[model samples]
Target: MMRVLAIGDIHGGLKALVQLLNKLEIKDGDTLIFMGDYVDGWSESAQVIQFLIELSEKINCIFIKGNHDVWCEEWLRDGSVDMTWYIHGGKETMESYSGFSKEDKQKHLAFFENLKMYHLDNKNRLFLHAGFTSMHGVEKEVFQTTLYFDRTLWEMALTMDKSIERDSELFPKRLTHYHEIYIGHTPTTNFGVEKPMNATNVWNVDTGAAFKGKLTAMDVETKSFWQSDNLPCLYPNEKGRNKD
Candidate 1:
């Protein structure tokens, strides 16, 4: 049977990503939905994007856009750099592209440009880089930025009373929009968890590969997950995004 897997933020950790793919033993029939932040953290951001482009050709894949992806796309298109991005890993991402030709960069730019802001599978499962705010649903969201930057939705889910049923008026309206939600952006490691976390119906898969955590991929059906080695161990000489 085909399995759908959800991959978390990479933050340029190509080594870890490779290890995870090997661990998963990916097959042709499986679908991989990658939550974004594909670049900006490790020393291989450019290489990671290139690798992903190649991987997509061989396997079924869906890419979601993240805030960092937006920054990198801007730089790829116009050489514009966001100062915050530079501090948080953009410098390494730019350096990773040292010898790439204009055409090569253009291809990567197109990859980023084509990424989806969100994906809703036939099962009513929602996947996005971050959260959306519309009480009605993602379709009615007012600010596009909230789709990739909002944290309130996750925060509310985390704090919600588990006993509250979906039919309860006390339950959050945002949580009722989808059968289940899977997201990246806020690392579960931040909450002292090093694995994928599920609160209410929202699953947070970002295990903090950009920092002192592992890269993760969870099978959406079984919730069985696989993780790469700790990112710090994969790149001992690099600080990744944990630098001061």
Candidate 2:
């Protein structure tokens, strides 16, 4: 059977991503869905994109755009820079592209330009970089930013009393419609886990790779997973963003 994997934010952690991919044992027939935020954070943004491009030639891959990725894409496409992104992880992402030729840079930009905001898999699962405001179809076109920044959904899930049957008055219909929703903007490390964190029907795969945690990947069919060593350890001498 073909494996389906969902990966979380890479945050330019090339070494960490390389190690995790090795552990994932990816095959040509497998389908991979990346949760995005591929650039900004660590110092290897260019290298990370290089790896993704190579990986695509061998396997089917879905790339979702995260807020950080949008900022980086803007910089690459028009020399536009956002100070907020720079203050967080954009500076490193820009620096990583300093040595690349224009052609190489354009190739990576094309990859960014083509990213999806969300992906619905064959198994009735929704894959995205962040939470969403509603399951209503039009929300994606109206409040697209919510798709990459909302957190109320996670908060609602966390507070639900699972022991009680879901009350439509209480439990959101949008969340229950999907068999599963996989997201990555909020790192599981914030919930104190170094692996994927499950809350209700949503799985937060981001293990804070942009910070001090690992880059994570999981097999949807088997519920099996792989992770890299603490990202800070992977780049010992480099201080990623505000890691002080």
Candidate 3:
């Protein structure tokens, strides 16, 4: 049977990503859904993108756009750099591409440009980098940034009374549209959890690879997951996003 795995934010931890994939023992029929933030944080941001591009040639992969990707894409498209991004790990990302040729950067730019903001699978499961606000679902979301930046959806799910049924008016309408939602952005480590976390029907897979946590991936059907050793351990000389 084919397995669908939802991977969390990479945040330039290419070493961790590789280790996790090796543990997964990925096969021909597996579908990998990446939850964005592929760059910025560690010293291998550029290398991570290069690897993902190559991996796509041999395996099925779906890439979602995240806030950090937006910053990198803008910089790649032009010379513009968001000061906020620079302070928050963008400097490492920029430094990671120091030796790449202009043509190579263009290819990476195209990859980012082609990423999807959200994906809805045949099973009514939604995969996105972050949250959406519209009660009508992702399609009706008026603000594009909210799709990759909003945390309200997850926050609501986390705080909602578990006893509240979907039919209850007290339940969040925004969540009722999908059978399940998989997202990344807010690190589960922030809540003291080192593994994938489920709040109501939303699964937060970002186990904080950008910080002191590990890179994570989950089999969506079984919720079985695999993780790499803590990113800090993999790059002991580097600070990652922990400097922030």
> By the lDDT metric, which is better: model 2 or model 3?
3
Off by over 4 Å in 1: none
lDDT (10s digit) by residue, model 3, range 179-219: 99999999999999999999889999999999999999999
lDDT of each: 0.96, 0.86, 0.96
lDDT accuracy of residue 58 in candidate 2: 82
Model 3 residue-pair collision total: 0
Error of 1 at 57 (Å): 0.5
| Model 1 per-residue lDDT tens digits across residues 118-228 | 999999999999999888999899888899999998899999989999999999888898999999999999999999999999999999999999999999999999999
Return whichever of 1 and 2 wins on TM-score.
Answer: 1
Off by over 4 Å in 2: 135-141, 166-169
Decide which is better by TM-score, 2 or 3.
3
lDDT of 1 at 201: 97
**Which stretches of candidate 3 lie above 4 Å from their native place?**
none
Q: Residue 90 lDDT in model 1?
A: 93
